[model samples]
Target: MQREGRRDSWEEEIKENSSAVERVLKLVEEDAVVLFSKSGCCISVAAKALLSTLGAHPTVHQLDKEKEGEEMEGALLTMLAAPPAVPAVFIGGKLVGGMEQLMSCHITGSLLPLLKEAGALWF
Candidate 1:
């Protein structure tokens, strides 16, 4: 976590307005649910599976496989201001966070509403 007023690595990255960040911003709007994850990450896979089961059919972008993945990863680091981990999930063109946040919404019965509002689900 970043200190209250101290600067961090992501500060500069976010300022540069890199193409990767631009791409991510575009992707989030293109789909109701966008998941930025790694193929080898089990939690990412599980999150994807869970959304699939819920009929969300989220758009997935794997950082480990793309040509611009490294750049995107850096962008994700800044986008996820909290813990800054993988499996960044965006819903309705909004950042809904990682697996834990997703599960929290699901467990709390709010996931369905989000999905429906995002047009990723009908029921």
Candidate 2:
């Protein structure tokens, strides 16, 4: 009974993880610009600010406040292989990576084009 209980628990965890991953995938697919963030994270705040400044009305999902946040965070970490996955940005249904990648694209003048393509920016 004890061993069976452990196995059942493991199965449930796997199910939840799968659901979280699916949820994240659906969110990224449905939005032009999706930002997975945590409210109190400074880098996330900066990412939001930068996108807003660039004319992107990003679909911001605050993982820390969401009901499935922890599971979603775990799924994000596994999917992106980026530790501390909050503040992850996805544009045009593609991973735009974290702050560093965002900064790089902006510096290279590529961010605006991508945003325009994604319909996150009109200009």
Candidate 3:
């Protein structure tokens, strides 16, 4: 009975987490700007800071090194085929490389225009 209870609890936890992940994925897929980032990475931090500075509240998907299994890695690889790296930015479902590219866009004042083009900005 105790074993069955534990299994039920674990199943519930899994279901809850799966639902959360699905929700996040749905938001990412639908959003104009989404970032797949690792928390402690410098580039990730920089990318987030830039977005914040621009007043762009991008949807961030935090990838856990330990929790993201082979399937997650494969999906990321498939999604971002070239110059594979963390802090991958997606604009309108298109992969936009890493922090450096983001910074370049910001510096060139193209970021806002791109966001506007994607119909992502309210201001």
Global lDDT scores for all candidate models = 0.86, 0.86, 0.67
**Which tens-of-lDDT digit does each residue in 33-117 have in candidate 2?**
9999988899998998999998898899999898999889887776565477878999998988888888999999999999999
TM-score of each: 0.86, 0.82, 0.64
Alpha-carbon deviation at 117 in model 1, angstroms: 0.4
lDDT by residue for model 3 (1-123), tens: 986886676566445456444544565678888887766877887787887677777777677743553334345544444345477787776666677788888888889988777767878
How many clashing pairs per prediction, in order? 0, 0, 0
Q: What ranges in model 2 sit over 4 Å off?
A: 1-16
| Candidate 1 local lDDT, 7-119, one digit each (tens) | 55557768775788888899899999999988789999999999999999988999888888888888887778655557999999998888899999999999999999999
For model 2, state the Cα shift of residue 69 in Å. 0.8
lDDT of 2: 0.86
Which 10-residue window in model 2 sums to the lowest lDDT?
6-15
| C-alpha positional error of residue 73 in candidate 3 after TM-score superposition, expressed in Å | 3.4
The regions of model 1 sitting more than 4 angstroms off are 1-11
